[model samples]
Target: MSANLLPSPMSDPIEFNNSIDLSDIGGTLTLAETTHDAWLPPEPVNTFEWLCENMHSHKGAPFNPVQFPWTKGICEAWDDPRTRNIWVKMGSRLGKTEVSLGCHACAQRHDPNTGMIGASTQRLLEKTIGDRFYGMMAKTPALADLCPPKHRQNSHKVSTRTFITYGAWSGSPTTLGDIDPKYVNLLEVSKWVREQKSESDSIELALARGSEIPDRKFLGESTPTIKGACRITKFVERASNEYFHVPCPHCNHHQRLRRNTTGERKDGGLMWDGGPEEAISPEKAYQTAHYVCESCHKNIDETQRRSMIQKGVWCGTGQRVDKNGELVGKPANGIRERSFNLSRMYGWTFTFADYARAYIESLSLSGQSFANDWEGEAWVPLKVEMEWEQLAKRLCVGDWELGQVPEGCYFLTCAVDVQVDHFVCATFGWDNRQRGCLIRHGTVDTWDQVREWIQRPYEALDGGSDMRARMTLIDSRDGNRKDEIINFCRSVNDEAGPHVYPSMGGNHGSMNLRFFRKLAIDADNEIGKKAKRNIVPGIHLIMINTTVFQEWMDNVMVNRVPGDDMSMMLPQCLIEDQDLFDQLLNEKLNKEKGIWEHIDTLVPNDMRDVFRYGRCAAEVLTNGNWARIPKHRPRQLPESEADRHQRQRRTAEQLNRNRESGGKPNQSKKRFVRRPSSTSSKRFVRRKSL
Candidate 1:
């Protein structure tokens, strides 16, 4: 969408868009014919109402401020006479950019005599207009004239009888200028430099530009980054620290949603399950995702997200909500500084499955990005290490053969750690809780044998049933035989299902929080340089966060018993295999470089690498749902056509009118009302693309 497709500021739909004739359609709806309603600011009003009525979004539609209940709290806070500083630490796609612009527009409507926006860099600061700010102004007839020149691009200033705004980035005080602005909006503060060229910090410099007027307001927001280094973290820590509270549709109990805290709260954050142990697929994992209520512990489907959010209220830390949904205590920071923390858990459009995808993608690295990007929390990177002797102690001594499955095993996974000369393979059988039994470990000299080994079923220690590998993950990180590894995996997958896959030991290039990402094969790599490439469609390499499994092994798995979730079990045969034990301790983390390296260069760490591979293979099948995955996954119905159409419908003139007038409905109580037409000739702006 561009500036030209923006909603017209005209109050009358006919005058706004003469292209469509509603008279011909009557009261019915159709595909070819749709609503062309437009809206504009009528007078000084509540910022939330103003945005919902007049402001156009980046999608070139009227704003839906109610989409996320948390957003409304921020918008309404702008009008609060008590608060001066309002901050929100937000997750991605939570409408931080739109809300920021709406507040600026609101400031322009009321106290917009002077305003400033500060960002991490000049590049980000200058993109405000091209991003959506200019389109927002150009869409409203009243604001279209108050701002934006002939086109809506990099608009610097909006000078009117009431408002003026200046763009500022990280720099000296000169960037803010000599004039004191009544409103200041600072974005991406986590990425901002701590200090400007002058003695004051970046945030202080931005806030210092605010006038000494009693009701002057400053807005700041960012997706939190590092734990100790984040600027937004510092700002939020000092404020009221508000959290969004929503009532459980089942229990009617209002509570804060803290993720993965089953024991601490009834709701266990975002919940999902892979199907049965043998049939789990990453593609199918998201379909079962849903939120678990903290109070009732019942599943909260995505359909309930909007309604629960609509009734949400902001409660500061240390404040609780009673059965009546009233705050039990005064706000932590009172009216001086109001702060909020928002995440996908509270978003209208987010599903539990969306987070399941993030969890899958985060398997290759430390799962901090999930906390930082989706949970709206700062993450502290862990410095992990493990001892070989300690891991050997957790080895389960059993009558099981080195090449056979254990007693309670349900499925098998094999991992091939490719070396320059040969492939070190480890076959592991897993229970539902991811407690592993190392079925076999050794070297395979040829690809033919490796392929046969992965397909063969191993006898169980209990002599019950034999199981073939559910998934075989082969390390393809080395450049030496990367092409061979990928080709072999692709051919095997083509022959069967996606049981065999080439694996990389790192974060996915796209996102950091997932356990694995089905990444596109690089068409320009050394392997792709060959002219005889037989790239299969829909066949991609799986980049597993080997570090996640590695860290779990070091910090949790190796220390726990077999009954503990995600614990590892080595066969008694490995007790005599001292070479495997030594190999496990070969790599240690280099704290200074943040990379793992061989403790002794001479020791072959194939067993260690293969151990990591087998665990990653388990994750490829399980997708990180080892803890508390629901057993029975019920099939859900496809969304109804009527619901889809209604969800996608634009704001009608009636709703816009009610919002524009602050919801003072006419005496008739009818669905439609007549209003006089105006000939402003206000044209729609194109949807601004940044």
Candidate 2:
């Protein structure tokens, strides 16, 4: 045998040197000819290929890639070194759990690294990992070989809390800490409890566990729930946001699929034979459903969706490159998460008719369920809620400054909110029609500064009048400063000046219906004793039902049609202030709880609360009515011809008497009085002797 037949030292140095026997065959045979040739392993397959080969469905069917073609890119992205974090926001029954389990199986087969898998609840964890995942392993021959003898003997041996290969835990933010893993899979993140005793959320805690590893990977999948509270929604917003763009079969124009409720037939969206306004049964709507091409006025039927999906591609809308032009997901500064958002519209597994049926069925149900389950989108409770852009568009543009009141304002109302370090105030002006304009808003550190602000009168733009706030409401919720606020209100409230009232906001179920109420002073209290001595009366606190007020404000902001009776105007000065706009739109209503709450507690909503307080003060000044009072009494119409003649004759007689008396009316003379035209002629007749 030649020397070339022998295994090179570079190929297998230890084997070539130690296992070779010169006396057997002059040491010319290769390692294949040696005894250990059968021990060599086969070449490794990629993650996607492995999944296609080894993943099985619950019905004992092999995984099919053609059914869910959109998942191909996701599985490939998981294996790509450029991508670390993969977040998928999709509708239900899209094979998210199956694909995730396939990736886990691939990891266990190839790398066998310690990892973590979590679900929103313990029951979900058991169903997904304990049943479905283990069943898949048992059905697939290749995957079954990788499982331990204990798991093979009994599937229940694989605990949900600590599964095979690594730790698997359930529960929310509480169970997410004190573990380091290379791979982390979080399922249904939207259902995870957001509020935790500690500072970090479940997602944050899970991400921190893989911080020390260089090639750590995380997968987050969920159907969005609330508008701003959904974890997957926020995750996709911060990640490389990608949408699936498909080609129109007729025009071949690429566009993302969207539900068209715009009511216009020509506009491109998901349209049916009859528009949304035309009421039809859910079954009929499903049969007639078709997609309208955005570019051309062509209809795409359900039969053509499969072909379109085959040619579909993901288009990234988020920033892929950093400011330094470096590619995202580089391991240096930590992995840049890649995110994908796909709705049920583009999914080939379900027909367009199925989606339309689901939508129609959801109409009879709640909007949130329809949005999350059918539309695969986040649900916003108030559809017409005020957004920053809408508020910005309503800004009054002119030469007006921040603190200057507009020309048409007749009265002003001020609201003060006490903070730990400062006092924030928002002052609004009202015209005769109750149209509101934000006059000024600012923060001051000292109470003296707040007093100076309240005392100074604001001059109108036209210089027609200078006026102070008609009513001021100070927030008394801060227990630390309640006494101070009450004392200040007591000192400032006067008959001749603007009435200052300490205000406390109540919950939704509070019995208080009136906007403002005077709290009953305790007869045995010190303040009541002082009031008895005529020193000072106890402060009147304005008790406001915050939920009711929030609902009213939401209605005013949302349902106020153009040229309507009510209008809320913001000054141009506030258009550029993003912080104020955020504060104004910060609160969200929880439909399930029937209450309003801020999205994030850490964010300062002082401007929002102050605006609410100011609105309450305005309501108080108007006697809980939004309309302004008329300036003059209206003229009465004549009841008959005789009444008209009598009124004319009386007017002429008065003019003649004034002229005869040298342009002066009679000082003391007996005259027959007649009632106005509204009453009978003889009803008010009386004789008086003078």
- The lDDT leader among the candidates is 1
Worst 10 residues of 1 by lDDT: 29-38
Q: With candidate 1 superimposed using the best TM-score fit, by how many Å does residue 24's alpha carbon deviate from the native?
A: 64
Give TM-scores for every candidate, taking all chains together and pairing residue i with residue i.
0.57, 0.49
RMSD of each: 21.5, 20.9
TM-score for candidate 2, residues paired by index: 0.49
lDDT of 2 by residue, 1-690 (tens): 533435565776443332444554544433544345434432345877877767787557898877777777788778876678888888766787778777877776666567677777666776776677677876888777654454343322243222343333434544566667777888887776654466876667777877778777788888877777777898887776777777888877777788888857678888666644325456787888888887797888888888887776666663233323233443222237777888888765678887777675444223455676667788776644666777666544434677787766667899999888999998898765545678888999976567656755675675454557888899988767766777667555532347787888875223223345555332222232243332334346777767545654554456543223335677666667878877777787875444577877877778888878887788777775444455322333424668646755864564454445543213323365544344564645554665
- lDDT per residue (tens digit) for residues 1-690 in model 1: 222334456744533433533444453322222243223233345887777778887557877767755777898788787888888898877888789888888777654467887777777776775566776777765476675465534445555545667777776467766768888888888776655346887677788776586667789988886667666877888888988888888887887765553323353566557543223444455776677776677888778777887888888877888767788988766768889898877776766677666655443334566777788887655543555565566565655778877667777899998877787888888776566778888888877667667866676555454567888889888877776776677656644533887878773212445667766564333332242243344456777665465555554433456555566777666666768877877776543333468888998878877787887778777776654433322233544668545633532343354345543313322344322234435433333332
Spell out the clash pairs found in candidate 2.
Answer: none
